[model samples]
Target: MIYGVVNLRREATLPLVVGNMNKQQQVIDTVIDTGFSGFLSLPSSIISALDLPWSASDIVTLGDGSETLFDLYAANVIWDGQYREIYIAESETEPLLGMALLYGHRLQIDAIEGGSVKIEAL
Candidate 1:
């Protein structure tokens, strides 16, 4: 099981450890974005700091229905006590943890500031 917390903004968030091929890693606070169907999104600064390798670029639709191209990078992430390789999209917004990363897991959120957030494997 993975444990997290709801922030003051009421967003369900999880702290994730993201790494590069060289083993450089950083702890990132990621907001849980159910509307996102991909794996993960991180800011350019973090990506640069980690020196994540570029994979490809793809156009993605935003929440406001606008389309924009995003640069994708290969990253290693520690999720639920396991090391997993996943794609990370470059975004200017706060890091986002999407449904792709949450698939096969049960998510429970209390929906309030300082509330508990939990993810249990199926």
Candidate 2:
């Protein structure tokens, strides 16, 4: 099971172990976003820091109903005790853990500041 906590902003933030092609790893916090269907969305700074390779481009609609093209990158994430390849979209905001990453897992959020958040494989 993976553990997390709700922040003052009421976001469920979880720790993620992300790696590059060379296997260099970094542990970072990512907010759980049920509205997003992709695996992950990261800022350009994180992408540059990790030296992630570009995979492709995709068109995604925003919450504001605007369509935009986004860059996709190849990334490896440690999920449920195993390393897996996942596509990460480039964004200018905080990292988001979306529905694709939550697939096959149960997510529980307390919805209060400093409250408990949990994710476990189904």
Q: Which digits, one per residue and each the tens of the lDDT, describe model 1 over residues 23-93?
A: 99999999999999889999999999999999999999989999999999999999889999999999999
Q: What is the per-residue lDDT of model 2 for residues 16-49, given as tens digits with 9 covering 90 to 100? A: 9999989988898999999998999999989999
How many pairs of residues collide in each model?
A: 0, 0
Q: Candidate 1, 67: how far from true, in Å?
A: 1.5
Provide the lowest-lDDT 10-residue window in model 2.
60-69
Reference-based TM-score, model 2: 0.96
Find the candidate with the highest lDDT and give its number: 1
> What shift in Å separates residue 18 of candidate 2 from its native position after superposition?
0.7
For model 1, what is the error of residue 82's alpha carbon versus the real structure, in angstroms, after optimal superposition? 0.8
- Provide the TM-score for each candidate, comma-separated: 0.97, 0.96
